[model samples]
Target: MSPVRRQHVILRVVAKLLIPYILLFALYVQFHGDYGPGGGFQAGVIFGAAFVLYGLIFGLERAKAAAPPRIIEILVSLGVLLFAGVGVASMFKGGNFLDYGVLEHDPLAGQHLGILVIELGVGITVTAAMITLYFYFAGRGRA
Candidate 1:
């Protein structure tokens, strides 16, 4: 192993322990955002932080391996599509743009569903964008 890796054994171990919990908390925040004090953007940042922590400790190359740039790019586009698609779907369903009330047989259920999906799209986009930025900036000025 390289000297740097050998020197950061403690950091690597701690990161391993913390990363899972961070991801779990992200999920909790994501699903619970509608009812409580959390949401897609927050969860996305937290999710991105886990990978950022991994990169800081393990090296950028390893982090990229864990989450490739291509996949992250795809997710960014996909997330936007998902979000916009929801709005378009609502239009098709005979409602105004993003009219969640038209999303289901019942307005309440449709509201729940629309919010959930929209939040998910936001989370995915933010997470991917964060990772992409990290990869771009980190890869710069490197040999």
Candidate 2:
């Protein structure tokens, strides 16, 4: 009815349309890192940016509801575990820590798999951390 309400509707429509594309691009960066210059770090930042944009367009409460703090913490821990688990697995495979050559029957495949897993871990951690930071800062001084 009001101008503010109309603007809100438009904003919501635009965000809903854009979020999927943003997340898809992030995935591309994550999976295509081996061939290109982008990697987990870049992908994570892009993924996190999508959430941050959602928060900016919607509200902090909605963002928190979408990604709870507990889930974020768990993702952070799991990312670390995933990264470290690769190293541990290599050790058990009779290779030095982070030695990807032992991850599979073929050394090249092993290295590729190892890099993918580690990059995934990195992406998870960075994405969670960035979202968590935004939640905390946005919620600061609130009742």
Candidate 3:
């Protein structure tokens, strides 16, 4: 254990308790985004914040172990691909790019599905990007 972890036992315990709830809240914000005020961006930030908090309380190495940089990079690309894939799929369905109306037999269902998928992509991208940024900045002075 590092000096910070050893010194801040209470903080570590508190963080352990809060991190799960934070992640859960992020999920709620993500799924409920379309009908409510929150959305992918908000959920992504919240999710990233949980990992950041874990990094702060525990240590950067441990956090990195939990969420590897390579995986994060892959997620960033995967999210963009997923977003664009949806648009392309819509086009293949005989609609304009990102035209969710043609995604399904029922236009309303297509719209719902499109929004859900795109928002999920946004959330993944944002979450991964945020963690990558944190890793970059936090690890900068170390090596």
Residue pairs that clash (backbone atoms under 3 angstroms), model 2: none
Cα TM-score of candidate 3: 0.97
Better of 2 and 3 by TM-score: 3
Distance (Å) between predicted and true CA of 75, model 1? 0.7
**lDDT: which is higher, 2 or 3?**
3
Candidate whose lDDT is highest: 3
What is the lDDT for 142 in model 3? 93
Sorted on lDDT, best first, the list reads 3, 1, 2
Candidate 2 per-residue lDDT, tens place, 1-143, comes to: 33454478878899999999999999999999999988889999999999999887887778888988899989988988999999999999999999999999999999999999999999999999999899889889674
The C-alpha stretches of model 3 lying farther than 4 A from their native spots are none
Instruction: Return the number of clashes found in candidate 2.
Output: 0
Candidate 3 accuracy as lDDT: 0.95
Candidates in order, TM-scores: namely 0.96, 0.92, 0.97
- Lowest-lDDT window of 10 residues in candidate 3? 1-10
lDDT (C-alpha) at residue 70 in model 2: 95
Q: Cα RMSDs of all predictions? A: 1.1, 2.3, 0.8
